[model samples]
Target: MSASAPTSFDKILIANRGEIACRVIRTARDLGYRTVAVFSDADRDALHVQLADEAVCIGEATASQSYLNMTAILDAARRTGANAVHPGYGFMSENAEFARACQAAGIVFIGPPVDAIHLMGSKRLSKIAMQDAGVPCIPGYEGEEQSDEQLLKEAKRIGLPLMIKASAGGGGRGMRVVTDASDIPEQLRSARSEAKNAFGSDELILERAVMRPRHVEIQVFGDTHGNVIHLGERDCSVQRRHQKVVEEAPSPAVDDALRARMGEAAVQAAKACDYVGAGTVEFLLDDKGDFFFLEMNTRLQVEHPVTELITGLDLVAWQIRVARGETLPLTQDQVQLNGHAMEVRLYAEDPAAGFMPQTGPVLAWQPASGEGVRIDHGLRAGYRVGSHYDPMLAKIIAWGDTREDARRRLIRAVEDTHLFGVTDNRRFLAAILRHPVFAEGAATTAFIGADFADDAGMHALAPQSHHWAIAAVLLSSQSPVTTRHWRNSGPHTQRLVLLQGDTRQTVSLAVSATAGPGVLDVTVGDQQHTVRLGASNQCIDNQSIEVDGVIRQPAWHRDGTQLWLDDAGQVFSISDVTHAPPATTAGAGTGQIRAPMDGAVLDVRCAEGDQVSKGQVMVLLEAMKIEHSLTSDVDGIVASVTVRNGDQVKGKQILLSITPDAPEA
Candidate 1:
């Protein structure tokens, strides 16, 4: 690879989808380069495709047939006469073979060198390289012996509470935590299976788990001219399922001294592999200020916005410049860090339901915008979020003079933003930001487990009386026959049942003449409240609800009998089940098994006529890049199997059925 000659290209192809692809297009267009977007059949009409100069359909919705199809991506670029390809993270970003193929095809790969990607893509090899470079690292086994017996023997030496990580991938996929010695074998098998399914490699790497440590990483930029520098650090400790949900720049836990040391180590790691372009060196920072090298991500990260906000630099632009054989724009001494910045990922998932990935049409989307706020997304009102990709929908970033200021601004941003129809973690993100531990900058990797047990009060929370009243008034107002519902000379009342989650409440509403028009008295249970709306018949859009004496401006979306309300930051989904029949509760030990979401069957652990116990793992479903173990709710005999291995199943589709065992006499 020669860095002496500058290479220039007129067209650049983005080899990814969603926000990241849209993100790259913005930068490439700004730099006067024509952008080509490659899309799968599912994303033919996606936001990124519409934003690009041209788009090519690569394959079907499945990742293996589209986004991961290297030949198809390269073919799209070749057909469009694109001389450059920017793999916008994920997909083929860390794929060394893809990079090498691009180089062979005479197309500029706007990322790290192929060798750097190959060495850093593997956790096992990267750890060895970091150790050889004299960087601080945790004691672990990254041996070539990948046998179960060998891993089990190594686990005994490493003791309990070790981390089982995939050597070929990250993003919490193919990773497991083994806290008991006896569970090592199962964890090893699970990790290897996931590793192969996700990265096509089942190689395992064991690391001594660093309990309750801050996940701090340095953003390092390298150019073809042999120059590399760090742009400070980011604290990414607030995570769930080993995936980061919130990230902030200039870690509150790191002082100037600690930053300098970590920054130097990150630069060393980049240079060790002769890296060029954008990369991240992750570290595990302990309470004593000591840090250990984790691994290096060979491409742009999902949380790069916060770092860009603090540094006032476009890392994507830097990658393009470096691909053109440019030198570092700023030296180590010239680099500067500005005010604090924080970002939170908005995912289409139900935090109360084990953070399971959700899929549906985005009925509405109104991202918050104001001073110091930035929303990066590719969402529109009617775009359908599919199960073929990741669940992350968008990212909200805020910058402020201080960490607290950023936190407060972020909380407000989350409150103002609204996305209905599909469930999200917006409220959950707000909870983490407002938590005392996070407010004090004391949160670690265990923050979610420690502070958000049972989803941090999210699951247990039922709609308040005010919520019910507001919902009832809104429902009554939206009725087509508004004359009888909104205005009544005599005493006229209506009763309705609103269901939220498993909690059902019957609310009675009556027109109240005391507060002029659009006023109604609502009663839920024994509590009565005065609910005033802005208009008599207006139910959708922005509405004002003055419950009792308190007033709140809430955004609402009504689809048929289902209503979604975003009051401040707390979101509620209320269904008008008044005319609907009472729902029958499936027996506690029912043998009906259904798929939770649209996914592919990875394994069927039971067969027809097989006896199964309640809580036994019956099937493994893979959806949105995560494996879900479906268990039997009752002990029974398998009567039928509707899904086979590698079969695609829709949400709520029955995977199998079992005949319940005879009850005790």
Candidate 2:
């Protein structure tokens, strides 16, 4: 029996987690709908749970045990008497089985139908449909054979540099680009395995990797009444590892004619799938604006805010409306393009450290705000950056009448953001905006990899600017400023060494007092730098500067390299020579106990001349937000410890050494 669609549901349950959950709940409540939320064991006290009108704990911390458990989510919805279920993008948003289950149980799934999802979610079937719909698609094999040898043959026919992709997944996972024949079979096998693990589908597809094509997508919406329309386009060419880090609407390159053609194709694709609710049709466009269909996201995208800003439409509210069996409220002719929009994904990763994930408590949290700036963040003032889920912490979006305005706004907003406790990529993002290539809008998927090979662009300034900036922030934020009392009233130059992990560099700066009491104008090598003092006057004053505009907390102290930053639930240290004392090889010890990796000491195990055995857990060193037990190298007594638990240790910091003493009996 087809249940009668209510004009509006009294309540809805969010079958997802994180920022999107909080985002949807806010809109739902504003629409006068009570919201129910679910959480895993680790997220019991998560911000989204607190924001919801009702909350329930589902399972453990792992994604499979909690968020992806469709039955558990549907069961929670049923138990809570929620008439509608909204899957926020990731976990089960595109799962056909989950939609079928919801329909079987009489709950409204706020997305496209199960048939639509099933038909389009399969990349193989979608390719056929798109080809049938007159959409310009790439020349590749969408054949039947699934054998490794068969796929290899097809790859040879399609030529080199082809993409081996999972037939049922997106998001750059379950995909591989093989450049040589020797790498094909292994990559094919890996792709299939990852596809199976991620989407429960080992079947794969092959496509010719387009050269320098821009990734532009159209946000499309459709209802059961067969009406579908597109809302402009998003430029997602600036990516890393095939995943988008920055997105913008009103693409700088796409002209009116190109948009209209792409929009028409998107609508036809949605109609072919009988798509319902909000979705985005992804496409790859060549330099001349000729395009090919990539995939149709059956759920709302994370960068939907850009579309909202450009089109002045509330996609979430529209999603709720369409789920209630409403027809398209407007036509294609009704859409209007007003402004430029951009969104930057802030992740808990150290870009300088090969983008490794970091976890820790949030010491300071100040998101950007003002005209045309918005922050969709799940974290609060004291939230811990976790490692179990995607590393994205918040999305900072900006909107303006012009693209230049949006860029300037983003740069200013990112600079104003003050984050602590956990390491964030704020400086890196800011640097991208100020970069010459990005400023000219000349970036592609290879832009980051090419421009940042040496990271010279992101870390553009010299050591003098950085040191003075840190000192300026510290002096301004901490101690009271007094008059510059130098007897000669000349430049007071000081030489200092800066250390990051195991690397060290020496630099000298001539510090001259500026016009302001807490201001300093410093000169390094041949360039002059200016710095404003911070609030604190103690250790680094009390303020920190944004590193390269990707807001990362600075870790420098007056003593040894004993800097601390937490990631997820663990603490990580930033080691340097300033924190590492001289090796204590004075006592009975062997060769030496060298620091394994660049990290900070969480604790020291044995003291000077303590009897120790082989394979013993001697010390605890933390790096990249995870702990490693620094065990003894040989069975003997530890001679002496040169570093403390809170001290930062470099790659070769000799903590202690077991001397070659009397033979162990």
On residues 332-403, what C-alpha lDDT tens digit does candidate 1 reach at each position?
999889899999999999878878999888888899989899999998887988888899999999999999
Which portions of model 1 miss their true places by more than 4 Å?
145-161, 174-190, 454-460, 483-485, 536-540, 582-588
Please give the lDDT score at residue 297 for candidate 1.
94
Rate residue 580 of model 2 by lDDT. Answer: 50
Candidate 2 per-residue lDDT, tens place, 525-552, comes to 4545555433432232223444333343
lDDT value, residue 26 of candidate 2 = 97
lDDT of each: 0.89, 0.74
The candidate maximizing lDDT is 1
